[model samples]
Target: MKKLSFTTPTAQKIYNDYFNRVSRCTRTLPEDDQREIMMEVNSHIYEATLAATPQTEVDILVDALESFGAPEVVLQALVADKKVKQATRTFNPRHVIQALYLNISNGVGFVLFGVIYLLIVAFGTLIVFKLIYPQHTGLFIREGHSFAFGFISELPGGLTELLGNWFIPVVAVLMVVFYFLNTLLFRLLKRK
Candidate 1:
């Protein structure tokens, strides 16, 4: 069996690169802590490399660093660990409520807008049906209805009647309902 040694210069370069990469992703660590973590990781890599066969030292070193995970992953794990520690210290109801409010308001606003858009589509379709097939306009409603409310057909010239009588009011009412529901949702989210 043969032995492989990493020269002092090679080791220095490897250690410096590791530290630099780790430091780039860490925001809260002091210089001392950062240096200590870098040293620990470098030492682990070196030890693993020594145990590998002579021809496998380079591969082992690379594998060890990769197994330690990327710099971002390391920083995230450290941050999460710190959070777990701090989370046990206190709980703030206001902050939780604020986060919940923001999330719910944004979610509900999207749903309300989508519903209003669909309603406008439905109203437009009704107008088109009334104009193209006035007799069949009542088909949209269930059987047994005595009168078919074909606003578009009721117009003097057809086009104006559709826009003026039914389509406009239906669209307006839908918009009002959408705005009211959105406002109510916003208030409910904020209250939570």
Candidate 2:
């Protein structure tokens, strides 16, 4: 990438420091991704500086950087986007978790996705609990109506264990359903 030239030392220092911050912000990405982001940001700043006919290098550069905003704030979307692409490509849980953390606040879709994931985890837990305490873990009925569906230490007088040995399979099917919902939501709500 071509370096921007500034007559004033302060302006030069500012430019260098800004790029340093950009490098830090993009450090977690792949090398090629890092270079692409750096180049794009450099291009924007350079264009902004060139378009303005300011009195001095410092003035022009300062205006450009100010319009560009701070690296951490401005580059978050770009970083989050690349992280999502990487996570999708790799199918790595760690990357997905990091991507979720980065973009969780951007929209309500991620929050819904998180809820579905939690439901899947809960179903998995139910399967384990059913194995550990078969008699106590299952759908419970009370007074001829469905009441609760989970493990309980003491069964109420009118409560009855409904699923029995079918609890594990039911929970497994629920896990699959939640997993599918999560997948569908991600596919629909993910940024292009």
Candidate 3:
């Protein structure tokens, strides 16, 4: 029920535009849910811009909105979250499909994260093969326009040979970092 007042006209206008987008995105949601999300975002914008000098107010507000990500992205995340909760509470096919669609679409970084994780695992396996073979260069080949991995006799060369010994440690570090990132992403999704 309270209002947010910005001293600068430009800052206020920016907030209005961003809030309008947020409102449009939340239209399909329940009134209470819509109100809750708006309140949280509104408070965040105020907190973010309150510390900024007048000259920096618009920039700070824009950055704050950007940090929340695109309006559609936030809506997808919220929809996915709601659908998950709804699915658990009921057996509606519509809810399940909605959740599935949102999740497969723009909801979370699930597919992208999963693909990256799988690639990391594959590369990690290749590194292990290199370590075990030691004598052989292994097989990761570039065939004119493409790449393949195996004992294909006369191929370009293995990733192990191309990358040398450093590949293993690098992949190991990447695996750890990606795992951490995936965890952080889930936490953010859960908060939504």
Candidate 4:
């Protein structure tokens, strides 16, 4: 940050105080960007005070700072803009938590999405478990017995083998498609 000069000690002190508060508020921003903003604000202050030639320098400085608004208000605007810029950037823990909270709080869509996903995963897992444990392959309930592919009684083995071969790939494709769709939906919902 460049050192700013003022004709009076009171003006210099006031400018420094206001900028210090602004700097503190912008600490969450990138270092270079923060420096740039501080410099820009400082330049604006100097120009405004210098242009107001009829008033005392201290009075001009005070009026300029006041007109620019409080540091806290300026900081809030900057921070909000920064957050919007970062929204599409890489994810961080803070962003993840914020997303989860927003979705869960906004409506039942998030819960429904989660439940549907869980059910799909559970069905896929159950099939995998039956395939792995051949002896315990009771995935379906018949009139008085539990059996795998019981509906295809004449081709039980063939049906089970066919499902076992294709279930994993189908589930995998569904997962990828759902992931993309969910992400798209989330982004759309957030914009709303």
The clash count for each model shown is 0, 0, 1, 0
Report the lDDT tens digits of candidate 3 across residue range 1-192: 355767799878887888888888776555777798888888876776676566576688888778778888766677567665664345254653454456676544656644654665676776766677643434343544454442333433533344456656766777778666755654455455
Q: Write the per-residue lDDT of candidate 4 for residues 1-192, one digit (tens) a residue.
A: 676788789988988899889888777666776887898888887788767868887888889999888878765756545543454354343643334443464567656555545554565665665567644433343444544541232333323243445555655666667655655655564476
- TM, every model: 0.34, 0.71, 0.45, 0.51
lDDT (tens digit, per residue) of candidate 2 on 80-157: 889877866775667777778887987899888777877777889888888898888999989896689988988778
Cα RMSD to native, each candidate? 14.2, 3.7, 14.6, 9.5
Better of 1 and 4 by TM-score: 4
- The Cα local distance difference test for each model comes to 0.50, 0.85, 0.63, 0.62
Of 3 and 4, which scores higher on lDDT? 3
TM-score, cand. 4: 0.51
The residue-by-residue lDDT of candidate 1 on 19-113, one tens digit each, is: 67876754344455556665666676667666666654445666766777777776565543333223222323333233332233346653554
Among all candidates shown, the one with the greatest lDDT: 2
Of 1 and 2, the candidate ranking higher by lDDT: 2
What's the true lDDT of residue 109 in model 2? 90
lDDT of 1: 0.50
Relative to the unseen true structure, what is the C-alpha lDDT of residue 56 in candidate 4, on a scale of 0 to 100?
Answer: 80
lDDT for position 32 in model 3: 79
| C-alpha root-mean-square deviation, candidate 1 | 14.2
> What C-alpha lDDT does candidate 4 achieve relative to the native structure?
0.62
